[model samples]
Target: MPSGGDRHARDLIWGRKSDALRDLNRRRVLRAIMVSPGTQVNLAKFTNLSQATVSGIVQELQRENLVVVDGNDNERGKKVSLSNVRGVAIGVEVSYDTVTVAARRVDGDVDRVVVDWSGRGAEHGSQAWMRECVQLIGEVVRRTGLDETDIVAIGLGIPAAVDPRTSTISQVAWALDWERGMDPGARLQEHFPGVPVIMDNEANFAAYGEYLYGAGRGTETMLFVKSSTSVSAGLIIRGLIYRGRHGLASEIGHLVMDPLGVVCQCGNRGCLETAVGGARLVEQVRGAYVGYRVDLPNSLANIVERAKSGDLLCRRVLQDAGRNIGIALSRTCNLLNPEKVFIGGELGRAVELVIEPAIQTMRLHSLGGMFNYVAPMTVEASELGLKAGAQGALAYALTVHHIRPN
Candidate 1:
């Protein structure tokens, strides 16, 4: 009973839907190219679509001026880089007491890198900190000679767990005492409306940071331990960070070392952090120096310095902490069998004073032969150190590209 006009309207609706689907498929194809530039044929295999479909999308993307393809010239095996030219990408790492940002040029060969830093904490209740972030970003963009419209996407890493379902923070009490109900992603989205704000846990980003530019370069699987105000770890397997169920995979600080031990901020007793975190280390050492107005370094840096000067007190304390860390690491190693274990954050440089005891304890408790070849598993100090979080933010944003396999 349909009239000609009704049939025409239905045809129009179907045409719009077809275009939308094509655009979606084109975006996916482009993502694959951006992820690994030289990759080919694999995108179709992974997408479970026909190679012809992928190729057609690629052609459409290229025609739209969003992607460019270059030939391998004489090399038959060399695949083209499905280059994207829409905009640059930015990454930000907002921590308890600091904000770090990084940016990179998206399209061209003139690689530009910008680093932004501010001492604004989550406790600042969003406004002051958001202002600082805006100022920093604006300053960096101007410094790099790119306009606001030139930024395509932004990624952020935070310490608190972000609920995957709600895209809201799961619990902020343990990490940020003041801003318990803030949604950092929403705040970021407010600033850069229209751009997607991708958020992740700090350890996940740190693991990727190490894998991309630091101690974990070329590692098949890596364990990155962050020892600072708190102790946490991240896992990188096959060169990708493992985000556990609910995006809270690497919560290593809460692995109970002693049920009767000191309570953690997470309401757990005797967590690894309760024993080896910066606050506890400083507290333990402060009682030794009474009236001298002793000021401890943010990390155990001063302790490492004192230990290097042959101070048995500092050495003993650090060694004890190392033993505790190793005890936790041994269990983790048994479970994951990682090829490398990297130490970062404030306490990373103290590996020399700590690694021996950690190694001894790890050997004592682990299952046989799992870690025998883990020799030179290289318990390395982070070259990136405290900057890892910030630097990782930038590199992550720039590198996550969408592409099509040709």
Candidate 2:
């Protein structure tokens, strides 16, 4: 016999699913309008629910002034749609080194912004910084002329392992201690009250962003490599972001290179990041120029500039890092054999210097047969640039899956 606790848990799952379903239907209707502006979604496309249910919900939404009928189909005889009032969703991406805030108008048009936080995760406390992020979101909403009432949800991205089903972030990312067990989705509730929020790892969101609006467009499968202040990877299959059994699939930074290597932030040893992470690379460069009166820039852009200006030392440093990174990617590619590879983030800006060696080394170490199919694996820069994570966060909010607030 089932116990009361089990029954309650089942009820919880059903409730969450129902709520998610309703949220999804709303988004689908809104998405149809956003794409065509004047394009109308046939009322029948919303077959996930009963006709009565869909009609009632659509009526409620119409009553709220959130949606409007653009016009009825005259040729084939169907309903048409256009968002009467723009609904809004907020997206925040908190990386190891920066904070980016953007406001998306779900109804009429889309707009976004990216900001680099001077205070990093490992430096100031996460909670203190989280409050700052909340404040920034408010500013974005105001600047965009979006009313909080129209914001159905907020999506957030962090560079850490997050359990998608349970919304329970992994214990491995101790580097971001402040976010541990904080329930990122719940935190936004404290600020927005009735509004919902969704949070995920930056890499997963980036992969989705690229799939929807960036390099992965029209591709069946894609793998995104994020080379930044810290490093991570995301996998997309059939246009869906794949988070492993424990929501820890893309923890490539912790992929051990040498069993006896240095310790990783995840308590592992000799991770790929230890060899080519931006911070690690910077440290190595600093070590190389001990007495040359040379000082390194705090950001990767400066390094790229110097490398572009004929600085042999800078070029060598980036190339070596790329070589190490490529070695790591080569091993991963052997396992997945994805169709395309897109690189993004800070270090990614120097793909020319780093990518060639990375690919050369990756090819040099890989199996011969894998090379027979695709030519050079189509390595390219991120089309989304800095907004990749934010775009992904908003995508998460709009999707049916994920443990985000809504």
Candidate 3:
């Protein structure tokens, strides 16, 4: 019993609702396509839309020249891909002493460039590291044959916790002396005006990278432990990086193992990092070889190489580190119960020397249910190695729907 005006108003509201729903559906389809190009039927499967709906949306996108259909197969069988978009997504990872950048075009031509520089300063709050990061980004993008204006989005991974709510560096990065509430993303955005810069913990991006293209590909829940100069962890659950409140969820390095042991850079005593971190292991090796008049290993990579070459002292240090990491990971496994655990970074390179001991120790300390014969939790070395963080950042940047070529 509505009047004419009331009926018209109701119709208008319904029309707006319908339009909004359609737009949302379109975005979902586009996001799925961005992740992996596919045919209309495969797109329907990925986007969870009806075949008819995917076909219609794809046809509309094709008409707008946003996507192109290729292959000489039938319409449904033809592969669909993004048109030769003029933009590229860039991923940058800032570690304690390194900056790595990766760039890829949205047109899916497999053209990508990855570059890394070592010995960069470790102060996350200082301008030195930021300047180096910007330089590496430019270098990598240029190698990809893309100009600065071709950048659409950038994903930056830092060695500190980022507050998810504010997108700022949190006090948890005390080891690097990063100021609380410092916004690295904002600084990068200044250089790439109008470009969206996404930031997260480097370990999180590394986990995402492994989940997308490396060892964690088939896992429903995976944990990636980056044992570098400092140790950190990242968790990926069901294809999404799990960032708990304050972005400190998987800070396994800060776990207090020995309350009376050496003080950590974070001011905590005897955290896992103090025991198994790269610096600590290197210190142990150097301490043992003091005044030996032999060519001693200077870095973790050198130590790993020496261990592989059957250096007993280097092997022992890595073995002890593996055992210590296992002890901490056992506690983490009891809580998150991930399907797989991947060891990445300098330590991961010595898989046979490190991973075997770590696995044995983890098996001893972890919950028995995690080691069931039917589906035992497995641990492996990262297939992507040191480049995981940068690759992950690149893939993550491309996942941002609005950043797609307009």
Best by lDDT: 3
Looking at model 2, which ten-residue stretch has the lowest summed lDDT? 1-10
Candidate lDDT (C-alpha), each: 0.65, 0.66, 0.79
Query: How many residue pairs clash per model?
Result: 9, 5, 0
- Worst 10-residue lDDT window for candidate 1 reads 1-10
**Clashing pairs in model 1?**
29-403, 29-404, 30-402, 30-403, 30-404, 31-402, 31-403, 32-403, 33-403
TM-score: model 3 vs. ground truth? 0.87
Q: What digit string (tens of lDDT, one per residue) describes model 3 on residues 1-44?
A: 11111111111111233346777677667656655577787778
Task: Indicate the residue-level lDDT of 384 in model 1.
Answer: 68
The deviation in Å at residue 30 for candidate 1 is: 3.8
Could you give candidate 1's per-residue lDDT for residues 52-138 as a string of tens digits? 787676667567555556666533233434343434556677666667776654443323457778878555656766687777777
TM-score-better candidate, 2 vs 3: 3
lDDT of 1: 0.65
Write down the TM-score of every candidate. Answer: 0.76, 0.80, 0.87
Candidate 1 regions off by >4 Å?
Answer: 1-26, 32-86, 108-112, 123-125, 178-182, 217-220, 292-316, 374-378, 391-406
